[model samples]
Target: MMYDCNLKIYQTLNVQSEFNIGLLLLYIIEGSSNISINGKTNMYKSNDMIVINDLDHYRILSSKKSVIACLFLSRVELDKFFRFNKKYYINKDKLDLSVLKFYMNKLIVNYVNDQSENEKQNKILEYINQLVMTLHLYRKLDGTIISNNIDVYSGINYMYEHYKEKLYIGKVATQCLLSVRRFSNKLEEVTGMRFNELLRNIRLSYSAFDLMYTKKLISQIANDNGFTNESGFITHFRDKYHITPAKFRKQLENDHYYPFHNKNTTLLRSFEHINDQIKYLTDRDVDYVSIDINMKNKIRSKISTPNLLIYIRDIETLTNNFQQSKLLSMRREIGLFGLLFSHQLFYELYQSNFENNKLVHQMFSFSLEHQFDISFEVKLGKNQNIEEFTLIFKRLLNYLTDCTYFYGQRSFQFYIDASYYQFNRISKIIQDNLKESKVILVLNKQNNYLAKRMSHKVNDNKQIACKVHHEIDSDKDITSILKNNPSLNILYQPNIPNRIESLISIFKWSIAFNQNISMIIDDTWLDSMIPSQSTHLMIKELQLNKESHYQLFELILTLKRLRGDIVYFNGLILMTHYLNEYQIIIFPNMKIFNRLHQRININGFKLGEIEYRHHDILIKNNQLIINSDGDTHQNMAEVSFKREIGKLIVQFYTSPYAIKHIYIKQKIN
Candidate 1:
């Protein structure tokens, strides 16, 4: 029986009653509408199309000024289409119909004009058939085929519900009222998997969920997921995922705690404790040199100077007021300064602010003589016009590139303050620029969506740096970002809690994510914390109280455990001064250590037996003396210590060059 195709145009708000007869296709050509299918709501914008199947109970809520073209295929027509092409069916509700808009418009025009000739009617039917076929072909091309048979649906539902049970194919076959052989063949035919394989896959998938979301024991997870034992589960998981379940969990934790820039880059979460401790040490004017056993040898010939990071608020004011001689003198006093400029300040200067330009040129000249890096901080919200901003930024970067080239230095970097909405729009531009030049793109406190997007675009050639401005709580979001982008250089803000537990949490998190982190300490905060002291007895007066000592020790230990770098802002001078006297060196984690051992094969460095303990650790003669926390010392070639010390002295161990390439390769895996 042939049934006519019905076409209706919705001009304004329109409601369609729930139906289970015909296959309905609603095309929004001019505007948008909201579609609800079984309580699940999705918005269909302009040039969007949605297909509602006979089985799907749906309602459409059209916009006030929407132009919707609705076409219905009667049950007879749907059945005839399915009989010939049983494997092809519309699976997705919403589809971007921009490509089909022309064809659909023609069909709508013909239907509205109502030319009732037989050929015209046949052409209308052909268009309807063509639309359905296109929808089917598109789904197949996109790998979105839906298993529509009732037996397959029921089997999948039963498997999902009973995946934890140790059930055999016979049991499922019995439940489905089929013989074991027939059931196996039917399952394979319907879902493209043998019954056992399907069951195992479901169990494995669920086990992964438990491993990531739950802190359950591996044995417990194995048992809960119907695996015979932990070893079996581990073997299966490793076979499928190429990483141990424990590593997966660690990765999840790391991604949760850090912001990922790319597969190889992650931003460490901010820790207030480290910052407070640094502030405390700087405030007390603690004599870090005096505590060092090698102070006389390291500091006797050199004046203690911290690394400097200078924040340039008004380059115009500085350049206008100061003489070049003064600028040169100021440059002579500082070492390794990082000059920061806000997006607005740079934009103004590039707009031909003469005084600012002069200041910039002078600064570059000073940097050429003194060796300092220029850091541009861009806040995305400030630029209302992203396209315009991109153009301006490109010009500024080109100018900076030229300036750096003239000065024979390449230390110009960008710190972008991005959010979800802005990053997506500018990601391509950023990626293109990254490929064309050598510049570090520092993303600060980006949302999950932007972070994920940026992470996917990262490659080995690009230098992507990520900084965490706040804590992240969503494990799923974090894990997704990290799983894709692992080679992230994480920068942690030192404003997080200072508790040992918190520090340990951060350490474990970093290791799990398999990324290196750096602590960004603000020099302004450090300087404000210090008290005025005369140069005469400064060393004697600069003493840490017991609490300050404990805080500093904890902070140092935390940094060491995480193998974290310390980036001193304006306080680089003070940091360098202290660093000269004492170094806080962290041993690599066990996984990293084994890799190092295999690659470096350094004398006295052994793998597998090394254990990290916290007790009395001493640094003397460029060697670490670790007091065993256990009663007897284990036969280990290397050991790490976590301890509270009165006179702590440290020396850093330079990592093997090969270790970096190995580390990056490991992360990629």
Candidate 2:
């Protein structure tokens, strides 16, 4: 058997091998270079030696003035010399040349020095034998060589080679001559993962490589890697790399941030970006601006002064409803009463009729289309069993999740009125599922006590916000009741109070404590009113006088300027004048907005010199246009109205700094 071992020096070499010429050994004595085997790239510095088997195609790009030593051995001759049938497998491409440096120098010296040909040949054989034994020992210690013992190492190697196939533990155990349970334990010990986990990881690794290199379709790659579907592949890829395969590939192509290359560093940079944005938005100097209470009180006193009524008489006629009893009788006569015949007939009929009415239907449809909040009511029968309660709660949750998927957006929050036990169960389910959806639970007197008690039992790490509703006179009583309940931060909702002092106190308390205050205005008309620090405002079955209605509009604008919290107006038909100033407004039904516009004076307000740029505005004679830009566009609103009405509403849904000034002109005709 004959093989070649030579010491060669090269200043620079850029070679792409078409075929591997036996086992090629490269020892770099000086300088550094990069080598690419197939598409995998690796760098080798000074004193590094690399062994490339005949099975691989490789390319070597040497740095300037680099020196390298090369040796080549035929597979047949190497097998004959080592007394082994199969070829040698180096665990890694690169190894430290230090161990072989001394022997290599000695061999060169012996060959160069004067000596008999047979003697030199004998020394060469001994040296080559020693090198093979050293590699074998190193391979064993590196855990990269498969042992000949057919039990453990061979079984693992087989799994690694055939992971894409449908593998069963029992079959593999039988092949390894071991019991199924023992094999399972041994597999876990060897891989540090269960059989299924290890198999999935192998497939995932291959898929990742293909994604980085191949131009194959994601579905085809998924199928090739034994994934049931593209979604499964995508889900697992996201879990491992924190991004989808397509996104990863795009990042690689664009030479942008690739998380997988240096995961911890990229993750830290991402967190830093988020932290910077948060700091910019919530800078203490900006968010915590101090407003003098004395000055606020003085301004409030001036604003709350009652003025002579400037009423729109037509609004009353437009919003007036037909006799309810007469409408019900007509429905019964026409045999159109299906659920109306039930015990809670009126409530059901009201909800159904309200939802089906053209204006109401339009409002609901528009809200859904624009991804605004849609409220659903769930009423529990008296004294229901736990199982029945849990089922209803679960159904409600499922509906919320379905809504999130259907809308293809997640800006909406769910509002539910539940008992203490029901809220407990719902909270547990939310925590277990790790849902990101927000839920606002409305509490009344009956369950408020139990909620406070359960607050103490909750985990401190858990986040919970409670809104408590109570009568105006019971402010001190409610405060005392909640004194011991430090675990829950309570927000108060007192029914609309008559005095301005009470309103100011409530608003100040809300701001001071970072809690919400709520008010329900039900038919009581006050002479003067101002905005409070209330998170929610529910007007229940109430119609205000024209002057009072105008005051409420002013209150809405003031609240918008103050906290910027979402205010929900339930069971109230807001006038067009009230709707003009808001960026986003939601109504219970479309009919309410329609009715408000029926006798609406286009001359209701003055028009401004409008500039229409982009797809931001549209005007149709008497109607107000509202639109959302599909799912990808968020926090945006586009509205326009004709100048014939002399009224113009300019609502900009962007950062405050981007707001444009409007030029108003009084109506001419």
Candidate 3:
């Protein structure tokens, strides 16, 4: 059998190939070859890395078809590897060979494995390293491969593994066996930034996840991720986002809305709110109605009539006393009931009833053909977080009554057992499970006192989520909310759509032409999130059934893949698994400017977002005019996920891209 100077030509390169004394230095340089380094005899594209030393025979074949780069270096070059491996061992498996993932992700040949020239350069290095290792000299050198550089390929691995915890500079220091000073210098050289800067970037990245995905509080976020106080958190958030935490949160609230079929307020409650239950599902052309809170429903009329009424039931009151009875009857009739005892001032009571009347009018009026308007404020003192309510709510109510002259108003219908916290808890249980969670609904029955008491504290926005605090809802109740709101479109894929084929197809094709795909993983932010995987797994046995669980597992795995993408957002996504496959371009979980989705080219050269010229990146108002300068399209996209407050983390897969666009708008003239 004949072999080329390059590690080339092997006819029997099957699953059981073994390495000879000096054959580890072989690299297939040109053409194509069937070289089985492992049990898989997969095709070797141009620049694929083959690292298998455990095979039975290192057969050499003269392939008119394949070219090889074999570096059977003279004994001296083999000596250099000994010196290079002094600080870190030059084992074929752990460091250079098995770190296939590291190389695949790197820009060199891993993610960019399509470049045969790069593959050639890497092959040359492999040969040289093998020579150095064979003579046992590369293992002896203390600081040879650029004295200051630590094996960064492994540092990233550490960050991926430990990013969720409070990682100290010292801990990373111990991993490298370098002094703090040495570590800092070397890290800067390898990572292109200082230690603190890298850490800040990590924090900022984590903040994005929190902003887009979790229900955690701002202050809690600070504490959970190792910050000492709220000020530190606000400062960090403001610095990165150019806005305060509250402001960021408000913006996020505008992005996601849950259609409320909420039983407490909707007046039309019976059914559960599902994606397919939107009103506009039947008619997409109609405008959505929102009852404006401004107009007051006056009881003024020349003719006598029963003007208003209220009803409160299912109560365990302090007493079935006459005073309680009197208050309940008046509030039930006059509409100002919640104001009298609510806070001593009754201002919020007036405000709430005013909005309630507006909603009532909208629901009853059919001639209202325009868009609706609405706003609401729910008091927190008596409902949720009772301790805080007791202190803060009591004080606020006193302030309302004392200075604001809200005292002595016989407006409220109060009950001893009424409280907001229990309302939310029971209501949420009922609303979420609909009919199937019967056991949960039954247990909730015992907590009716808390539910009724807390019910008034909730405000359903009517547009987004109809938050029924009901533990179980009938279809009719859910449908009523949809029937009332006739504008928004609704659709649902009730069962989890099988996304496996889509993912596998992407992987296979990503390797073929070497698609450019990138992934960025952010573990720290994922850790701080409350609803976690480990918890869900534990709860699955207690709460969920088999089919429901399979979908959950699929979702978790999908998230893990997404996390992997988030970690290395700025670089190449290396696919080093299964026989040194190939390279591709990719951008994982980057916050691209929502408007610029299609306007820019999202591959190659520089990584970032872009802005288009003359046309809105997204069809804001339609007229999309093509720019002639073509070159004016700016490069890159904006951050993918921006705000964390009030944002719901739903699952969806979007194609990641980078491109150029123009920034033509310059404020005012």
Candidate 4:
């Protein structure tokens, strides 16, 4: 590491500066100044800061005087710590340079104190690393960072959507309207993978999903995903995953908590959601339940579910039954943590009922009965006028204040339902009020706000999350979302996928990338609570019904147990190592649904008591053997199983989602 002592200390007072060869960090010490960087002008007041990249031109103008400390560091050196991609830029509105300012101040003091060059170099390097981390840098594909080139992304997108078909660099280049050579260069720049390499990854990623989620044969999967032959596909799969396709599938199955295709019919039916099936599952494991309440629905009997999220479509239903619902009583007795209703209904209620109205007072009473958080789904319609919204917002504050008096300040959270543009308007209003409560700006699938860096400064209490009404199962889409909205949480609404396995894969992707997510499954998607006829048949056991729904719930409960550091995550496998346990979620990334034939081998785990399908699973001689026909096959490949290491391998069976839970009695000593 090298530091140019000549550029160590500088005081800028209404002067222009250019960073043609290195990065410059400008910190405002006193007074206020107008600064322009790369043609974007913003006011830099006391404690304000900005990082100007190399080759960027910036100018400062102060009316009286301003003390600005500028530290210029070689960008080439910074690249050793971070890629410093050209496309990465901190928007003026989105900049949170407080952390950077702290480091910059320390580095400046070191320079002023005349520290040793090596010491200064080490400190400066620490500062540079901190700056990059604070920015929440996105991951790079292969080695190349995400490119901003529309053509390059377009080319990638073209390849992604049609990777199943025969693809050539020329065909994709032509689709992106770029020459072969130009497209090849751009693709390499964006992915750090050549045309064939990138295409193979795309195919392999999809094929991997198929391998886990579908029952497609290796040859068919390879052929469908555009691989010329099974051997080539196996070679590529092994090259990327470091395992043969057969072995990879086997490992996923053996590690699963419960095999989806269990041979025993009696064991499968035991997990189905019958008459109190939801209650049974929730009693065992479930953090919260998202249930809808309508005007016709009466105050039903309450179950001992820990947390409740009451979804009220309109105010009429809320006013009609919310106060009377057993949920309110449950909140007081046990504790239902949260309630949700639409903002439209709230506005209508306020307009219909005067201030200090009886209904509003009663609503506040029920909410204040327990210290549960209230979330209002604030939806902004297309034709909604800002003036009208502002007026309603004023009334909302008054309404919130009345409740705040009872519920205490900052107890309410606003769930703003808005498009990308609408979010900007409502967020500004909320911020303008100086409200410290948590605000979640919820966006829809059509809104690409997640991909674009938000221009609004998200306060400490505020978090923005994208809420999609549909299922996002594509690996590419998940990767793109995680990369673009590194700070945003994800909320999936209405229904869990038809297949629990798909969701397991999605959850793995989120966990692997260290992203926060919420999945809400509405009652409607459960296909009615009516119990289906019990047949001693396997096919009948695995149909999509309430049983399967509850099974999904059980799977969610199991998934939540995976809490710790994500040691490794590729598209195919996710490894999470916690203090008490280490969990692995392995799924194939196929776009289609098919039945899989699997032979699994479990290794690296100490065999203890195993809980699978309510039967005692024994590991003999470090090998677990089970045939497809409810019989033990001792001839299978033997793997090491140690008693010192216990693992929970949850496997999803067809029709019913069976969870295999292995609890380690002792921690690693």
Question: TM-score for each prediction?
Answer: 0.33, 0.26, 0.20, 0.43
Each prediction's total of clashing residue pairs, residues at least 3 apart in sequence or on different chains, is 27, 5, 108, 28
Off by over 4 Å in 4: 1-310, 314-337, 347-351, 354-359, 419-421, 432-434, 445-451, 472-478, 495-502, 521-549, 567-575, 581-657, 667-669
| lDDT per residue (tens digit) for residues 488-522 in model 2 | 44433334432222333444444333343433222
What tens-digit string does per-residue lDDT give for candidate 1 at 1-669?
A: 011224555555444545333467777755678889756899888667677754355767765556666676544344344332332335453343532443465565455443556666666666665566555543432223343555554555567668888788888777777788987877776555787776776677667667645789999999998999999999988776667888877765233321111232222223232344224322331111111122222222222112233445565423543333333443443323355565676767657743345557765566555565656667676447877777776766566656656776654555556654555445555445443433345654445455555656666434455655334532455556656667666555444323223333333455456555544433232221232234653443244221132342334333432211222111101111232122222332211111111111122111222222223222121133233232322322332222223222222221211111011001111
Question: Which of the two candidates, 2 or 3, achieves a greater lDDT against the reference?
Answer: 2
lDDT value, residue 71 of candidate 2: 53
Evaluate all candidate structures by whole-model CA lDDT and list the values in order.
Answer: 0.47, 0.43, 0.32, 0.52
* Model 2: colliding residue pairs: 359-590, 359-591, 360-590, 360-591, 602-645
For model 1, the local distance difference test gives 0.47
* Models ranked on lDDT: 4, 1, 2, 3
User: Local error of candidate 3 at 164, Å?
Assistant: 4.3
How well does candidate 1 score on lDDT at residue 219? 96
Q: Please, what are the lDDT tens digits per residue for candidate 4 over residues 462-514?
A: 67766644445444554676676666666655444344655555565555455
Q: Using lDDT as the measure, name the better of candidate 3 and candidate 4.
A: 4
User: Per-residue CA lDDT of candidate 3, range 1-669, in tens?
Assistant: 001121222322222223221224434434555654323455664444554331113333333444333333211122232333223323343233212322221212221123454465554455334334333422324333333344543453355346557777788777867777877876666555677766665565455446444778888777765566879878887776667767765664332211111222111112123113223222221111111111122112111111111111112121234323433343333223121122222334343443344532332121112111111123333334645444443433333233223223211112222233443443343234322211111112233333223233323311122222221221344344334433211211112222222333333222332222211111111112112335544464333322233232222232222211111111212211111111112322122111122111121112122221311122111122233334323323232321223221111121222211122111232
- The global Cα lDDT (0 to 1) of model 2 is 0.43
